[model samples]
Target: MAQDPPAQDLMHYESMAQDALRGVVKAALKKAAAPEGLPGAHHFYITFKTEAPGVSGPDDLLSKYPDEMTIVLQHRYWDLAPGETFFSVTLHFGGQPKRLSVPYSAVTRFYDPSVQFLLQFEAPAGEAAASAAEAAAPSPPPAAPSAGEGEAKIVSLDQFRKK
Candidate 1:
């Protein structure tokens, strides 16, 4: 017989915690990106996927780092704008200014060395991330990999919807 209804969901709790932590990062970025600016020794080191969804940056600079890149937001940056889902800033490289826009979801680590605080996140997965991973990986010919080749069938929810 089935036991009493399960009471606690550990994964749900963990997801909530993760969201709250992400919010903290957003808040910190907002503060540091503000006009008042970094408020006395506060700076950020944000590391994120270069190929992840919603991440846009100078092609030359991004190509130098194929997978991940870390940016320090301390000085010599401009137009630091933090949006609801992403942030953009202008930074100097090789004596030239370059701009980058990164989605918060793509960020893997956020740190403040001055305060010795750190937050880390798992690699985010999405259409772009999945596509990027697929492009980077080698695959057999399309004809060689068929659904009947031990692959699970993909269900289309559209089949259940009214036309």
Candidate 2:
């Protein structure tokens, strides 16, 4: 039997995993929204691309974050409305409150350190194929319960290679 030629421009599974992972974040937010507040101590650290499309926020914030910014969802955040395409929230910054609306597609990382959980995705590439792949499959297996709900899978890419 002969081995096949290496797959051409293989799709990155991590992106698919991110799609699945974003669902987890959306679910958590939904649960939080359902009861009028987040349960217990659950909160999120959302990191996103400031330059991505469909992202809107204060000009100062955009300037400060430049390419990427991380926001904490605790204590002073308000109006946390999660939607199918994006989420809108208000948080106090520099003693002033500001509102931000970011698409899920704009987000690059989400983490709940209380559970040691994280989900990371690649930045959008200005290419049709990559975009197609992303649109086709997004998300990953939900955070494992035993590993602590919502925890990012700490994977070593080298491990998957043939020895």
Top candidate on lDDT is 1
Q: Write the per-residue lDDT of candidate 1 for residues 42-148, one digit (tens) a residue.
A: 77778778888888988997886666777777766789898888889887665567889998888877877678777877677564566467769866422211123
Flag regions of model 2 displaced more than 4 Å. Answer: 8-15, 127-163
lDDT of each candidate versus the true structure: 0.72, 0.68
Give model 1 RMSD, 1 decimal. 15.6
Q: Candidate 1 — worst ten consecutive residues by lDDT sum?
A: 149-158
lDDT, model 1: 0.72
What TM-score number comes out for model 1?
0.69
Taking the tens digit of each residue's C-alpha lDDT, what string does model 2 give over 1-163?
9999988756877667777777887887777666567767776778777788888988975786555667767556778899987898887665567888988878777776667677776675553365567569865422211222332222222222246
